[model samples]
Target: ELKVEQNPLFLSMQEGKNYTIYCNYSTTSDRLYWYRQDPGKSLESLFVLLSNGAVKQEGRLMASLDTKARLSTLHITAAVHDLSATYFCAVDKSYGQNFVFGPGTRLSVLP
Candidate 1:
């Protein structure tokens, strides 16, 4: 069975601060995705790390994957109140298999 875990399940940071959220999985998977969800809202796709050493960034958020270590990271730079949301990391073992998701990290960015 594949297991996924995330650190600091809940985070509270002030605006302009920076932090990183970590995701670790039990299996070897080259495909990983990062997502965001606002309270009571649907999930939003953030990044797709398709291979080892893959990294993606948009605006103030960046995501990276290290397949050999079965680890993925989401880094937030200069956070803002608008960035307050629950973040998730999902690993896909195969094309047709269900994605294993990490327990989301709920982030609250104070102004």
Candidate 2:
């Protein structure tokens, strides 16, 4: 069975600071996705990492995948209050398989 875990499930930071959220999977997976959810809202797709060393960035958020290590990271640079939300990482063992999601990391950016 594949399981996913995230570190520092809850994070509190000040605006303009930088932080990273890590996702680790118990099994090998070549595809990873990052999603964001605001309170009482649906999840929003942030990034899709399709291969080893794949990296994507939008605005202040960046995401990378390292398939060899079964790890993915979401890096937030210059965090702002608008970026405060729950972030989730999901991985699938292979194509067409159900994705296993990490317990979300709740982030709060104080002004």
Candidate 3:
């Protein structure tokens, strides 16, 4: 069975600081994804890591994947109040394009 896990389920950060959220999976996968969601809003795709060493960055957030380690990371740089949101990482299942998601990391940026 494949399982995805994320660390630091809740994070409190000061504006302008940097932080990293980790995602670990129990099985092998070549694809990973990062998503963000605001309170009372649906998730928005932030990145799609398609292969080993694949990385994507947008604004203050960057996501990377390491298939060898079955791990992925979401890095926050120069966090701002607008960057506060819940983030999730998911790994693609062995079959098709289905994905299993991690719980979520709720980030709060304090100004």
Candidate 4:
């Protein structure tokens, strides 16, 4: 077990579509984060789900975390071409900046 797991490394979502991606982890973690990245660009903060049942959303993206189950989710609503990018969920193991990232979800939102 590599501590964290994410499924369907790639997604091709049509415009106006909706989808959900999952993240599962082992052991206890301090924080979970969802980040978006454009091609060859730095990460853009999406959501930071802190505790159990913590949910946060912005624009067409929503994220939720369940600490007890060590799980997290990122949901996309009404996808658009501008949403094409990579999404990553990282788990903070240490109190500091130590983080483990999922393989990443590569999304291609086509019109």
Question: Which of the numbered candidates is closest to the native, going by highest lDDT?
Answer: 2
- Give lDDT per model, in order: 0.93, 0.94, 0.93, 0.88
- lDDT of candidate model 2 versus the reference: 0.94
Candidate 2: C-alpha RMSD to true structure equals 0.8
lDDT of 3 by residue, 21-103 (tens): 99999998999989899999999999999999998888888899999999899999999999999999988897588999999
In model 3, where do residues sit more than 4 Å from their true spots? none
Where's the lowest-lDDT run of ten residues in candidate 1? 89-98
- CA RMSD (A), model 1: 0.9
All candidates: TM-score: 0.96, 0.97, 0.97, 0.92
| TM-score result, candidate 4 | 0.92
Instruction: Write candidate 1's Cα lDDT for 75-106 as tens digits.
Output: 99999999999999998966564798899999
Q: After superposition, how far is residue 85 of candidate 2 from its true place, in Å?
A: 0.2
Error of 4 at 105 (Å): 0.5
Regions more than 4 Å wrong, model 1: none
lDDT, model 4: 0.88
Could you tell me how far off, in angstroms, the CA of residue 34 lies in candidate 2 after the best superposition? 0.3
